[model samples]
Target: MKRLVALLFALALAGATQAQDGPAAEAEAAARMLEEATRALDDASAARDRVKALTQTVRAYEAGLQAMREGLRRAAVRQQALERDLAAREEEIAQLLGVLQSMSHTPAPVTMLHPTGPVGAARSGMILADVTPGLNARVVKLRAKLDDLVVLRALQDSAANRLEDGLRGAQAARAALSQAIADRTDLPRRFTEDPVKTALLIASTESLDGFASGLSQIAADPTGAPGPAAELAKGSLPLPVQGRLLRGAGEADAAGIKRPGILVAAPPRALVTAPAAATLRYRGPLLDYGDVAILEPRSGLLIVLAGMETTFGETGEVLPAGSPVGLMGGLEPDDDGIVPARLQDPGSDWTQTLYIEVRQDNTPVDPAQWFRTDKDD
Candidate 1:
């Protein structure tokens, strides 16, 4: 029985250690990612391609923040499971303790003896042999649960500091990237924008279709040549931002209003980029669609991204594939590093939605047919 107990105890310890390591390892890896992002930010200042470097820094921070959130979520779930297990096993734990205590205090000779006779003693011994193993198994599970609770609780406490650092780093990287984009003047210009014509076009149009049909009116004339055609990129272009599909094309919202575009639910302050080399046909507020970016990748192919808080690049500039376009808006984190309310609540925090539409020859097409949406972001 002692040997069995010892073996069970060892197994329980191992199990508890493994359980504790899972979330702890995830948190550590996330911290490393945040650290790498910080390094990237430092490197951006001296990089020949400041926009690219800052972009990488911003993306790194996003990845780290995501990982950290996932780690905390896992830890919280594990803690809850441990708490439930402990609560459910309260009676079993008490019984196990009582039995072990009673066995410990009883003299060995007394435990072996039976009140009736040698036969009764033999039977009692056999019964004890059968029950002892089960009791030890229960004891092992209880010990493991207790250990896991302690480790997970401690992990949560330590994680707060790491999470705060990562949040601050992410904010700094975003600000730097925004500045880098604004200061950029190296991108080629496809055409010069006629602001008066663009304004007239917006004032005369009430829908995206109407506005798209009149896009050419805003451009003075073609100057720089267009980039390589995006025909081969069909059905394989990455989404402009890292997010999940909130609504498919032509899906109606709660208000029963339907648009021929897809809505992508992204985290707050997420970066939006150009999925292909394209000209910045027009960017800014239009009607009730919020800030918009219209990209012309080919003569008749137009990609429109709307609902961002900010947009980058002047109209008619040729943007390379994966260039920063804008950022999704959200409430800022509180002072002292408390996570933003949006981030604290993951279920509803995808408050920022990027509206994406692909138009061919002045008609809206299903964005999914152009952008790949099968993989997790």
Candidate 2:
């Protein structure tokens, strides 16, 4: 009987020992598996064909790791509960052994031991069965689950880091491509030839009021010419203004339209003199005409002063040739208060300008043909 009891105790001790070691073994195995998965991900990142596949694998690994982490938490909880239960059971067993020892010490008559019948034997057998095996099995299972969770967490972290790096690389590549394209393509310049004529016309109409009056007279003309009817009939018109021709008369395009005029660059605020002695036909600002002046100088020519802001003579006022009409003002500054006012060129010192237009009848004619350097002739 003593030998049988000792054997049963030995079996329970062995079972307990197995249960304690199972979790550690399982944890080690899971760690090895996680390391293998990490290596596979690194290999995928290096391979071109397998890069996409690697990304997917990394995501999967990450998910698995998260699930493993949760599992580890649960396993830890279970392990704690199991440990508490085992401790309580151990305490109870210790108390029972103490009671048994105390009972043994009590003075009692020793009775003759007799073997029970089959039913009694079976009941005794059931009572002696060890529960250590079941406890060991549960502990081993929990340990294995915890190990798997640890492995999964490691994999997930690695995958997340790789994904971040990949995204940054992709963004950088795209930016480089865009910059390359921009470098290859040449952008258009802001200033173009289309605005040349428009600028010239604007320069022609520097004075607003004079331009207006000139257009009104042309509109009221019976011969439909830009000058007085009497002057037009005689095949002569008034000189617009008196200024040295800086640019010769020619055809130029402005704002996508052809304009015929002579660019007569003059001194800033210089007095505009009439080309001939004639009546003041118009003296006001016109559309595209700044301060302008039109005079019927003789039967053959019409002079136009396009930059005059103020005029001395009214319509029908008689004036002799080379008379002072208006003063020239500089171009107004832009809204930003920045003015690009400078001399036309290094050779020409004149910054302010007045445009002079000469016309035959209603059509513009070359001023070079009729304009003389001196009025002495």
Candidate 3:
């Protein structure tokens, strides 16, 4: 790679020695631009690796934190439920005790010893209506309390377990986040050119056409580090994210447009992973496709995952299968709180849909053939 860069540098110097005011000068500038672009690709690849590693770490940490948050939410709900149960039980117990005390109170003196008198008979009838039912009510309330107590104890145990899991998850997340930050901060770059050239290259960062043009000029195998031959694993690749498939490749949509990729139904903030070990071609906002990610699992094969609200990492990074790429977007499962409404595409109903497209030789192909189909099946 260094040799290639040196050769480009030599070309630039040669053009300068033969400096002319016509086509020759234009050729020199073109050569320099090509050289700069090539060098930028190399540097980007290295920097992106750092970004990918860090992104994976950060995503992992997020997963852990999410778990912890969910745990706390569940625990709190259970705690509230337990409190309600206790309060209800206390009220019922107090009512039952009152009935029992009333029944035990000595009968009025007029009816105490007048066994066959009118007052005594009337009092006996009152005992059947009031005292007998109170005794039965006590039995029922006692049994209900027993059942409730069992449930309350079980809930307590579950809450304790979830809280423990949350604590461990929190610890793991912190460690991963710290490590990711350190790795990203320590990464070095390959391009050490003059600040002006560096600035020019940076301007082309998000310009796909310019960047692609630069990649076109570079010879394959120039660095002797050939990329993965991902074609060999075709028809057996895994889906990047875990979820149900909403649309298959080449399927027509409601808008009467044929889809090039498959759409998968995923929750907001769900984990997105690489289907295979490969380099990330690009990760950024693309035309009308919110937060897209392009990965090269193998030479000549491009895998695109798009329609995310947020994504991690950058362009030019390579990672193993199952490595974190980014997260999907949707309203949280347990959240129904009020939020400011925003105008969205009528065709795009839920924000949780992720589009997947696999291109071989830059042509769209059926992704179902490469990935695990019938995901739910």
- For all predictions, the C-alpha RMSD in Å is 3.3, 34.1, 25.4
lDDT per residue as tens, model 1, 34-144: 889989888889999999988888889988877777776677777777899778877976676566555666766787778898999999879988987786767666677
Q: Candidate 3, residue 181: CA error in Å?
A: 6.9
TM-score of each: 0.88, 0.32, 0.48
Q: Tell me the TM-score of model 2.
A: 0.32
Task: Return model 1's CA RMSD, one decimal.
Answer: 3.3
Off by over 4 Å in 3: 1-221, 229-235, 330-351
lDDT of each: 0.80, 0.44, 0.53
- Poorest stretch of ten by lDDT in candidate 1: 332-341
- Candidate 3 lDDT over residue span 58-119, tens digit each: 34433443333333334334445646776877876576555545544545554345567878
Q: In candidate 3, how many Å is residue 27 off?
A: 68
lDDT, candidate 2, 204-267, per-residue tens: 6644333432343332233332332342223232333323545555645365533355565543
Best by TM-score: 1
Deviation (Å) of 2 in candidate 2: 99
Alpha-carbon runs more than 4 Å astray in model 2: 1-244, 253-258, 299-301, 331-348, 373-377
